[model samples]
Target: MSATDLSASPSAPARSRTVVASLRLLRSELRIIAGRRRNQAGILVLASVPVLIAVALKFSQPREGRGPDFISSATSNGIFVSLTALSIEIALFLPLAVAALAGDTIAGEANIGTLRYLLTVPVDRTRLLAVKFVSLVLGACFGVLVVAVTGVIVGGALFGLGPTTLLSGSQIGLADALARLALAVLYLSAGLAGLAAIGLFISTLTEQPIGAMIAITVVSTAMWILDGIPQLEWLQPWLLVHYWTAFSDAFRDPIFYEQMRQGLLVALGYVVVFVSLAWARFTQKDITS
Candidate 1:
C-alpha cells in the first residue's frame, strides 16, 4: 500500500505531511537566499577581498632575507596576512554579518506578515524553527568557507606553496601547514558559531529585524569592551570575543593545544546557551504579531 492508502486507513497524516512540508520549506528558504541579488553580490565582494589582499601583498613586498629556506617566505607572509585579515574582519565585521543574517532570518518573515501564513500550514513551530536555524547557520558557514579557501588559493597562486611559519617561533612542514590551516579554519568557525547563536537569540526577542541586529551588535561590542578592561581581565575567560583571536595560538611553536581546547569549550558553551535561550523564548512567542 502507498502513503495514500495509509492515510485513508487509520494513520494520522501528521508524519507524512511534516516531511512534505519540511522539504517544501527548505526549498523556499534556499530559493529566497539564492535569488537575492544583494546577498549574491555581497558574497562575491567578500570573496574578492582576500584575493585582492593576496595580490597586493605579492607585489608590494620589498626583497628581504632569502625568504623561508624550507618554504617560501612570500607564501608564509601571505598566509599570515590573509589569516590575520580574516581574524580582524571576523572580530570587526562578522558580528554585523551574523546579526544581519540571523537577526532577520525569522523576524523578517514576521515583519512582512508571512509568518502567519507559515503558521497557517500544518507545520509545527518547533520543526519550522529548527529548519530555519539550520539553513541560516549553514549559510553562515558557507560564507566563512568562501573566505578561507579564497585566502589559501590566492596565497598559493601568488606567493607559491610553502611551509607554515609561526610568529611564535618554529616552522611547520608541508603536512603540518595543511593541518594547521585546517585547524585554524575550524577554530575560526567555532568563534563565528557563538556569534551566530547570539544573533539568533536576539532575533527571537523582537519582531523588528533591525532591532535584533542592533541589539546583538551592542552585545558584541559590550563584551569586547568588558574583555578589554584591565580590572575585568578575569572575565576574559567567560567572554566569547576573547577567543576570537585565539586561532593565532594554533601557529605557536609547540601549538598551544590547551588554549585551543579552552577556546573551543568556551565557543561550544556560548552556542549551546544562546541557542537554547532562543528556542525557549521562541516556543512561548505569540504569533499575534
Candidate 2:
C-alpha cells in the first residue's frame, strides 16, 4: 500500500474506535444481564416490592384509616411516609444491586483471566469506567422508574385518583397531583445515582461481589438506623439515608423546598465524591483479579 493510503487507514480506525468500544461494552453488558438469571430475578423482585406493599396495605386498611389521600400524604404531610416506603428502599436496594453488578464487572473479568485480553482491545481505562458507571446508573434509573410507576398506578387504582385533601384540609387537583408524583420520582433518581456511584466504588475496592453488595446494604441500613434515633436528629441533615424519603415533600401545599434542595445537594455531592474516589482507586490499583 502507498504511504498516504496506509496513513489514511490508520486515521479511519482511530476515528471509529470510540463508537466501536462503546457498542462492544453495551453488548457485553446486555449479555451479562441475559445470562445472570438470579440477578435478573432479583431485579424484578426489587422493582415489584413497593407495588406489592401498596396493594396489600390498600386491602388491609379502611380507606379513611389508611391516612389522607395517598398522593397528598406522600407529597405533603406524608412526605416521611411516602419516602419511607419508596425512596428509602431505593437508596438501599439500588446500591446493593449496583454493587453486585459492578463489583464483578472488573474483578469477574480478572478472575476469568479475561481482563488482560479486554485491556489489549484498545479501550482506555477511563472510557471503560465511564461506560460501566453510566450503564449502572441507567439500569438503576429504570428499576426506580418501575417502582414509581407501579406504585402510582396501583395506589391510584385502589385508593382513587382525584383531588386529595391535604392535612391542612386543602384540596389539590388530579393534574397537579400527578405532576408532583412525577417530580418525586425524578428527585428519587438523583439519590439513586449517588447510591450507584457508591456501589461502583465499593465494587472497585474488592474482588468479592457479594462483599461489595453487603457493604452497600449495610451502610444504607446503618444510615437509616441513625435517622430513626431522635438524639441524632442533627446527623439527619448530613446522612445520605436522611434524604431517601425526602421526595415526599414535593406534594405539600407550599412544597418542602428546603428539604428538597438539601436532598439534591447531598445526593449530588455523594455522586461526585463516590465517582471521584472510584476513578482514583480503580485507575491506580493493580489488577490481580
Candidate 3:
C-alpha cells in the first residue's frame, strides 16, 4: 500500500482520490487493526493455541480424539501439528478473533466519535467500507498464519520435518506437506471471511463493538448447531460452517475438491450478501458521532 496521506486531505485532487487514496486508506486501516492492544492480545492467544497443542503432544503419548485424525499423527510428523491445531482452533478461537476485529471495524470508530470526522473527509462511505472489509479479511488470514507458523516451529523442534502421511497412508516430502498446510490455512481463512462479512454488516447496525462481536459469534455458533442437527440435514448443506472441516480432505493423496469448492462457494455467497446489506445500511445511516 502507498504511504498514508497523513495530512488531512479534505480537498485532495480527484485524481489522487482514485486508487491512491484508497490504498492510503487501506494502509491506515491495516495499521489501526495491527496497533490495537486488544487485537495484539487476540493474535497472541491465536499463536499460543498451536504452541500449547504441540507442547502437550510432545510430553504425552498420542491419544485418540474426536477431532481430525491428524491429532494422533502429530508425533509421527510435526506438520500434522499445524493441521491438528487448526482443526481445533477453527471451532472457536479463530472465529472469536475475527469477530472481535470485524466488530470493531466501523462500530469502534463510531463509538470513539471519529466516524463522523472520517466521513467528513473526501473518502466516500463505500470506499471506507471496502477498506474496512479488506482489513478484516487480512486480519483473518493473519490469525490463521500465526497459528500455522507457531505450530510449524514448535512441532518441528519436537518432531522431525519428515514426510507427511496422507489419509490414504501414502507419504509426501516435507515441502509438499507444507504446501498442503498452506492450502488448508487459505481454505480455513476463506471460511472465516464469511463470518467477518457478517460482523461487518452487524457492525454497521450498532455503535457497541461488543454487541456486534457477540452477535457475530452467536450467528456462527447457531450455524454450527444447525449443521450438527440430524433433523436439519437438508439445511446443513447451505450452512457457512458445513464444509469448514473439509480442509482435512486436502490431506488425501488425490486431494478432494468437492467439499472445498462447496465451502468456497458458500463463503462467497455469504460475503456478497452481507457486504451488500452493510453497504445499503451504512450509506443511509446518519452518523451523529
Candidate 4:
C-alpha cells in the first residue's frame, strides 16, 4: 500500500496506535536514562547525602545556625533528616545532578553519533524532545525520592521516628508530616524540572556533551551566587534559585502558600520559555552532528 493509503486507511485506529506508541517511547526514554551509569551514580550520590547527614548528626551536636533549622533538630526527630538533607543538597548537589542528566540528553547522543540514527526513526523531533524532557523529569524525581526515602530509613533507625514539629513550634501527626514530605518532594521535583528545561535548551546549542554539562552547571552556580548576594536582593524573585528554599514553608502549621505559589509560578515560567526555545531550535537546526 502507498504511504497515503496506510495513513488514511482507518485513520482513527492509526491515531490511537500512534498515541500508544508515543506512550511507550516515553518509557523507552526513561529506561535509557535510568540505565546510564552516570545517571545511576548521580542517584546514588543523592541518596548518600541523607545517610551521611544522619550519621554525622547522630554522632555529634550541631551548633545553632550551623545549617538549616531542621539540621539543628535532626537529632530530635527522624523526619527532620529528610528535610535537612534536602536543604543541604538543594543548593548544589541536586542542581548539579539534574544539570548533568539534562545537559547530556541531546548533546550526548549527538556526541556519540546516535542522534542522527535516532532521528532516522519515525519519531518527530518535537515528540523526541518531549519524551526526553519527560524522562529527565522522571529521573530527577527518582533521585529526589531516593534521598527522601533513604533519609527516612536511616533517620528512623538513628533517631527514631516521631511526629514532626512545625516551624511554628506546633506538632503534627507522623502521617501528616509524611504527607507534607511528599509535597516537599513534589515541589522540589517541579523546580528541578525547570532546571532540566534550561539544560535541555543548552544541550541543543552544543554537540559536546561535556561542554553542555559544564555550561549548565556553571550557569546554575552563577545563579546561586547571584541569589546569595545582598546587593542582588532585589533580583531574588526573578532568580530561578531564589524561591527554592520555599519548600520549607510546607512544614508550617497552615502551610504557607505564598512563597510556594510564587516558586511554582516562576518554575512554570522557566519551563515554558526554555522548552519552547529547545523545541524551536531542535526542530530547525541541521543534524550535522
Candidate 5:
C-alpha cells in the first residue's frame, strides 16, 4: 500500500502493526550500521585519536604556552585531552564519519537490491527515510562519544583528572569540567547531525553509495574551505560548519552559550530543511533497484 493508504487505513490493528514493524526496522538498521566493517573501522580510528593525543602529551612537554590553549593545559589537566582531540577531529574526522554513515543510508540499500524489497514489505518511503535519518543521527552521537569518552579515559590514565582550567584563565572543578565536555560532545554531535541531513539528501540522488559518500565529503569540505576565506566573512555565519569549533567556547570561564546556541539553531535548520528535501525526493523517485 502507498504511504497515503498507510495513513488512511481505518483499522487500528493495521496502524499498530505498522508502528511495530517500523520499530523493528529501526533496530535492524542500527544493528546493520554497528556491524558494518567500515563503520567499525571508523569507530576504532576515531577512538584512537584521543589515545594518541594522551600518549603524545605524556612523552613530550606540551608547548609550555602556545597553540590551542588546551594543548598547553594538557599536562596540568586531563580534561584537555578530550577537548584537544575533538578540536583536531571536528574539522575532518568527525564530519567524514557522519558522511560515511549518512551517505550509505538509502543509496547503500538500493545498491544491494534491498530498497525495492523494503518497499514491497510495506515499509513506506517516509518511514524508511525517517529511520535512515535517525540512524545517522544516532551514528553521529556514537561517533562523537567514542572520541570524547576514549579521550577522557586515556587522558585521565596518563595525566590524572582534576580541576580544569578555562580559556578565560579561571578554573573549575572536575565535576564542572566534565559537564563542559558533555556539552561540547552534544554540540559537535548536533553539528554532525546537520551534515548527516545533507548526506541523506545526497544519498537519494544516486544508487552508488561511494558516489554519495564522496559527494557528502565534498560538500562538507567545500563549506570548511569557504568558511575559512576572509572574503567570505559575510557568508560564514550562514555556513553550518561556522560554529563547529565554537564548542570550545564552553571552556570559557562564564561558559559562552551564545555561539553554541546559534550553532544549534543552524544545525536544527539544516536538519529540518534537508530531511524535508530528502523525503520529497525519495517519495517521488522511482526505486528500480
Candidate 6:
C-alpha cells in the first residue's frame, strides 16, 4: 500500500473505535440513570399526575376558572383528561422531573466519586459529556412520555374515549386528537430540553447533586414568578418558561403554529447556549472527584 493509503487505513479504525466507545459510554450512562432510585421515584410521581387528575375530575365537576378550560370538558371525552393533566403538570412537575434527572447528570456522579473513575477510562471528555447529555435528554423525554401515556390510560378509563373538540370549537376524530396529543407531548418535551440543558450546565458547576437540583429549580421558579408579573411583561418574551403553555396551540382546529413556533425557537436558543457552555466548562475543568 502507498503511504497515504496506510495513513488513511489507521484513521478509519480510530474513528470506528471512537464511535464504538461512545456508544458503550451512552449505554452505561443510560443504565446508571435508569437504576437510580430517585429517577425511578420521579417517573412514578409524574405518572401519578394523570391518575390524580382523572380521579379528581371523575369525582367532582370543574368550576369556572378553577383549571384549564379543557378540564371542564374532560369528563365528556377521555383525551381531554390527558391534556388537562399535562397543562397542570407542565408548569411545575414536568420541569421538576427534568431538573431532577438533568441536574444530577454530572454533579451526582462526581459527589459519589465515580466521575473521576469514569474519566480515567478510554472515553474522551467531550464524548463523555455528550453521552451524559443525550442520556439526560432521553430521560427527560421519558418522563414526559410517562405522563402522557398514563394520562391516556387513566383518562380513557375514567371518562369514555371518543372524538375531541378543538380549542377553536371544531371537532376532530379520536385518532386525530391522539395524534395532536403526541405532537403536544413532543412540544412539551422539546420545551423541557432547554431546561435540561440549563440543568446540565448547572450540574457541571457543583459537586453536590442536591445543590444543582435546587439551583435549577430556583431558577425555574424565578422565571415563573417574573413571567407572572405585569411589570415584568417586557422580559416575558425573553424568559425560558414564557411560551411553555403554547403547546395548547397544537389543539387548535387549524393548528396554530405561531406561539408553538416561537416557543420552539426560544427553547432551541437556550439549549444551544447552555449546552455550549457545558461543553466548554467540562472540557477545561479539572476533575478531582
Worst 10 residues of 6 by lDDT: 60-69
Ranked candidates (lDDT, high to low): 5, 3, 4, 6, 1, 2
Q: Superposing all C-alpha atoms, what RMSD in Å does each candidate have to the true structure?
A: 5.5, 5.7, 5.6, 4.0, 3.9, 2.7
lDDT of 3 by residue, 49-159 (tens): 878888888888656765557878888888888888888888889999989998788898999988988898856899899999989999999999999988898899898
* lDDT value for model 3: 0.89
Tens digits of per-residue lDDT, candidate 5, 1-289, equal: 8998777767878779878988898899999999989899999999999999889879975465578778888777788889999999998999899888976899989999889988998788999999999889999999999998898899998888987768788889989988888999999999999999999999999999989989999999999999999999999998999999999998997989999999999999999999999999999998888
Of candidate 1, the 10-residue stretch with the lowest lDDT total is 66-75
Cα error of candidate 3 at position 276, Å: 0.4
Candidate 5 residue pairs in backbone clash: none
Highest-scoring model, lDDT = 5
> Per-residue lDDT for 189-286 in model 4, tens only?
99889899999999999998888888888887899999989998888898788888999899998999899899999999999999999999999999
What local lDDT score does residue 267 receive in model 1, on the 0 to 100 scale? 85
lDDT tens digits, residues 31-85, model 2? 7754788778867776576566665564554454444344335432222233335
Clashing pairs in 1: none
The reply for model 4, stretches above 4 Å from the true place, is 1-12, 62-66
TM-score of candidate 1 to 2 decimals: 0.81
CA deviation > 4 Å runs, candidate 2: 1-24, 27-31, 61-88, 166-169
TM-score of 2: 0.78
Question: What's the lDDT of the predicted structure labeled candidate 1?
Answer: 0.74
TM for candidate 6 is 0.93
The candidate with the higher lDDT, 1 or 4, is 4
